[model samples]
Target: MSSPSDSTACDLYDADRPLNMRCACGRNHGRGAEIEVSPDDKLEASLMKALFPVDSVRRGFLRAVGANTARAAIASVLPLGTLQAMAQDKAPLEKTNLKIGFIPITCATPLIMAHPLGFYQKQGLNVEVVKTAGWALIRDKMLNKEYDATHFLSPMPLAISMGAGSNQVAMNVATIQNTNGQAITLANKHKDKRDPKMWKGMKFAVPFEYSMHNFLLRYYVAEAGLNPDTDIQIRVVPPPEMVANLRAGNIDGYLGPDPFNQRAVFEEIGFLHLLTRDLWNGHPCCAFGTSAEFIEKNPNTFAALVRSVLTASAMARDPKNRELVAKVIAPAQYLNQPETVISQVLTGKFADGLGNIRTVPDRADFDPIPWQSMAVWMLTQMKRWGYVKGDVNYRQIAEKVFLLTDAKKRMKELGQAAPEGAYPKFTIMGKVFDPAKPDDYVKSFAISKMA
Candidate 1:
């Protein structure tokens, strides 16, 4: 076979013809056509058609300089060889059949929906999204490598990477699965005590210690001049059991993921005390991610996986698709909850359990962009709450753990505009969280567990 440098340059930049269309040379070509041809084939066809627009002149030129020289000339101009290699480059998947784990909550919508919607199959992947019991089990399975990827609490990856709750394993957050979808639910008895100051001495539940729920809950209570570690009793309870705990009065309230928060309101055991969105609007709740080793071992598979989830996230972001997404992921195979409960969480329209119907369309959103600032903030909280002990390299860990680059690329691939920047300033409860000065931010907190 003639080397790429030896091939002649073909004038294949046709403005009118579709990229995938067959050229006059009886070969398929196009600029953006959805043709089945490999990238190399497409490039070759386009080049041949362009170089020899008039078959007689092209034949004469090729006969003179030869095909190899022509290729070298073309390579010198457009780097067609490199482009063709990229187009045709299909990285063989290290593993195709994969098991991904996710909790049965609205926060895991993108990952769960990807399966039913055939997004995984579209990328030549066979993904089994196992409905995990809770966040702790999900973490365990991930560390054990029983699950290749998982629905993670946005902070879990950071904590896991640092060996906080599990052995130190480098993990990466592929995307923020859902944001601002969590709520602090209180037993109906505490409805009269609507203030956080009144929450002192009350027992509250969070899905995991290394969860956004925990951090946000602590921040919310601390901002009220109450110590999260001493003033309030915070317990690690699985989300599905939160409502039950509320019903049994096992816990006074919980800052947890949906549809459990909504489920509590549905069960009439608790009222929506406050949405986490109220504490920090647009806060990231959960993430879609896997271990760093997995990404390193299967780069293409991971890329395809990120693209599939990003596609699902793009669909889930649309309000028009929320109701449909609710139905699709509500079955026993996925969330295993009432469709109405899931719908309320996904659509952002639900009863506040006080007879008021609240409508906040962005109450829960699948933004998919894993902002590094989010990770930075989580680190600050981890430091604030004594999760990570000494001087923490906040930005380095944030960049290492959150796959912002991959998330942005996949978002763009799915026609979504990726948000710019590594660390964006966030206003949590009216206080600016400058990720640049996390230690200062931690020091600013009055009721932290920090000594």
Candidate 2:
């Protein structure tokens, strides 16, 4: 459905206008002026025919609005590229029924809620969002392919991929499940010792060694002139047991995921000292991903899984939906926490264990972008703390493990705002981290274990 500039050009054949030209300078165009007929053009033509099979009606419609205007109107209603992609992406999933592991924490809000909300089913994927015991088990299961996909600490994938704490298995973080949802909680007995300088020789628990909890805690105390390695005891305590450990005096405090932070406050055993977001706003805590092998072998299924989680992430981002999400994911099958504690964590209105209800709405967020720069920062920390030795290819490892570009592309396709590329700078504890100068950034730290 088009009109040519030259009066000599006759319309294409159907019922109204008969074809007059064959393959030549005039073919599918005016005698002199021409417009390229693209595949999009063919698609539009077919859609036009379907809409108005009677050629006279189609001709009248085009005459009234003109081809350019008509195209603009239709495209505004339904983008042609999106429509074509939807039509073409109906491939059978290589693996439909899948088990996706998750630690029962609010950091996994999107992945956990996707199951109850049927977002996975919408993509024709039957997903079981299994409540996992801890982060190490999540890693082991992923390594064994016992779980098709799982919730991961944002740094876990990078660590696992580099063989930092486990055997090397190539992993890819598809999307950050949640951000700014972790906190440093302290035993109520030590509430007077809010200063990190006073925390010397104190025992602390982190969900995993390869976690933002560990990195951020190290960074926090390190900035306070306390070497996290020698001055503090950082234990790998499972999140579910963090509150119990705090209650039993097994650990003095923890930099851990919620609703455990809120759980400790609710149980009167601990108080929230500072949210990790205070250390670095919009910092990624947990990620949703599968191995690179899984993604390659089950591209369609992986895409479906990503689409489902992203849909849930969008839903969870709205503050209005936080309470609903808390309710949805608070059942015994998911986070297994009290609704009030989960609500406090998700809605950001909670007792700080010192007689104050803090209302910081961005306290937790579902920012799905797995920024590669975050990976770069994690790598720098690994090197700084002697977790990884020798020369490290920060950018190469970051780009391979954190699928930021793919996340952005998928976000764009999902009609979400895909922020510009991967390596945006981050401000942590008043220090600017330039991803391009990761080595310098690490060396700049005063209390690192770097040789």
Give the number of the best model, judged by lDDT: 2
- The 10-residue segment of model 1 with minimum total lDDT is 7-16
Clashes of each: 15, 0
lDDT of 2 by residue, 256-358 (tens): 9999999988898989899988999999989999999999999988888887788779878988778767777877888878889999988989899999989
lDDT of each: 0.80, 0.82
Measured over all alpha carbons after superposition, the RMSD of each candidate to the real structure, in angstroms, is: 13.5, 14.1
lDDT of 1 by residue, 114-143 (tens): 786556755668899898888889999998
Cα error, candidate 1, residue 307 (Å): 0.5
**Backbone clash tally for model 1?**
15
The global Cα lDDT (0 to 1) of model 1 is 0.80
Q: What is the lDDT of candidate 2?
A: 0.82
Model 2 steric clash total: 0
